[model samples]
Target: MYNSQEIVSISNRNIPSLITLPAELVYSILDNLDMLTILISFCNVCKRLKNITNTYHRYKTFTILNLTHHRINEQEFECLVNTLQNNKTLIEIHLRCNKIDNQKTKSLTDVLKTNTILTTLVLSNNTISTDGAQYLANLLNNNKTLKELDLGWNQITSEGIRYIADALNNNHTLTILNLQINNLGNQGTQYLTNALENNRTLMTLILSNNCIDYEGAQYLANMLCKNKTLTTLILSDNRIGSQGVKYLANALYNNKTLTKLHLRLNRINSDGAKYLADALHNNNTLTELHLGWNDIGNQGVQYLSNALYNNHTLHILHLQYNKIDCIGAQYIADALQKNTTLRELYLACNKIKNQGAQYLLNILKNNQTLTTINIQSNKIDFHEIQYLIDILEKQRIQF
Candidate 1:
């Protein structure tokens, strides 16, 4: 009994000193610690940190999955949702890899309806179906605080996309929406295009690797012609072949808001390239155009050179992995004498030889705006490499 009383006296002496430390310092110590372990271990520690009976903001960002990557049950999910709802300072919630279904969606919606300060919500790799998507859309329509919503790698089909489109029609605060790798096909793309046509708040939309083909390209291109809000449009790895390329080219002739366009891995051959080159002469807002890994060869290069004479808005042009030889290089070099806005030009991995490298060197001799030129992984000889290196060294010295 004497020994027990002595131990209790020592423990009582330590309690006051632990509490005497500043609250800010205590919170800062917890902040620097790894959040995943801290959140899981806090409940096991003494009552001060573990007691949700005291304050709610002790847990800001919830990651229910412990270090072992086990599934967090519905009860634990509800606890996290309630804790986040009670704490207004919660800014980011990452529920990645958790199999969240419709029932979980309701619990999440309840929390979202009350939480007004959340800015970034990541629900990737979850099993939220059409019903859950509809619930999320309803919550997003009125909530204006969220800025980024990532639903990538989810099996959200056309039905879910429709709900998202309806939500995007009125939700003006959201800036970045990433829905890549999802099975949103032509039907879903049409709904998204409709939303984009009327919604003017979104600035970046990434729809790569989603199997959206020529018809879907036309749907988005028609919207791009009139939307006047979107700046970056990524359509790589899609089957936007010759016809789709022409459709986008025609839209580019009048659309003045889009600045960057990614058309890599698309079957845009010389004929389609000619149409796009013609549009480049009239379009003035586009700054970056990526046409890598396509079939646009020497004929396409010649056509693009014709547009380069008058085009002044394009600053970066990527033409890697095309069958452009010395003849195509000469055409671009001739235009480089007069065209002035282009700064970065990527011609790597093309089957260009020493003659083509010499033509490019001649262009670099007189061109003023060219900054970084990538001619790597090509079949150029020693003489051509020496000449290009010498030119670059002389230009650096002058600058």
Candidate 2:
């Protein structure tokens, strides 16, 4: 047995001091850690480590500037903004669910004026009204590096959207913009549609859960007819009815650049589905279509199935929660036999019974292209599930 002094000597000899290591080696270890870990664990360990972590280049793409769930006050937010301004390497900043108002937004805009490396900024679930939006729009006029901006669930109304539209008319580097769950009525949508006519850089636009009516849908459809750069459009959970679907279908027949369209949780019915089917027969560029949670019944499924027999480019189809019955499943199963390009099919939460499940299982025996089929929450029995598992196991071996 050794004495206490000898034990201390042995432990000290075994454990080398991390602070005594070379600066280059310490930086190499800190470079592998994420921003949150570095900030929380190493930033306050010593002055030297904090300086080294601040200068690390790996933080260029550091995401999640999240203040949500943390009781951060104004002084802390200002300090954070100051730190961000000094570090010229950050690429993304997420300020979601932070309850930020116009006063807080001023600090962010001040940093945006000089920060040239940030490309994505998410300000979702805040209280940014017209004044805050104007500040951001003003920054957009000069900032050239920002490419993606998300302002979902904010208090942006038509007046606020107008400011953003005016900025978008001239800004060229922004490519993706998300404004979902705002108060963009017909007037605001018109402003955006008009701006899109001249803007050439934006590609993806999301307007889900907005109060856009059929008239507003008409404005966007008109833009789609002439806009050549936009490829993804999400308009889910709006009030666009069958009439709006007809207008969009007409535009889709002539437009050739859009590749993805999401119209989930709208008021579209069988008539709307028929109109979209007509458009699908002529449109060749669309590869993904989401029409989930609409009241498109068996009649609507029949129309879409007939269209899918000839449509070759569509690779993904989402028809979940649409009250589809066994006959509707049969129609889709028949289309799966003829449609070769479809790789994914989402049919969950419908009224598909055992017969529908059997029909799909039988089709799966020969369908080699389909990689995924979601049929959960249906009326399938235990035996049907077992049979499906057996068929999938066999297919796995065959492949």
TM-score leader: 2
Give, for candidate 2, the lowest lDDT window spanning 10 residues.
390-399
Residue range 127-210, candidate 2, lDDT tens digits: 999999999898788889999999999999999999999999999999999999999888989999999988899999999988
Q: Each candidate's TM vs. the true structure?
A: 0.82, 0.86
Clashes of each: 0, 0
Best by lDDT: 2
lDDT (C-alpha, whole model) for all candidates: 0.78, 0.85
Q: What's the distance in Å from true for residue 108, model 1?
A: 4.0
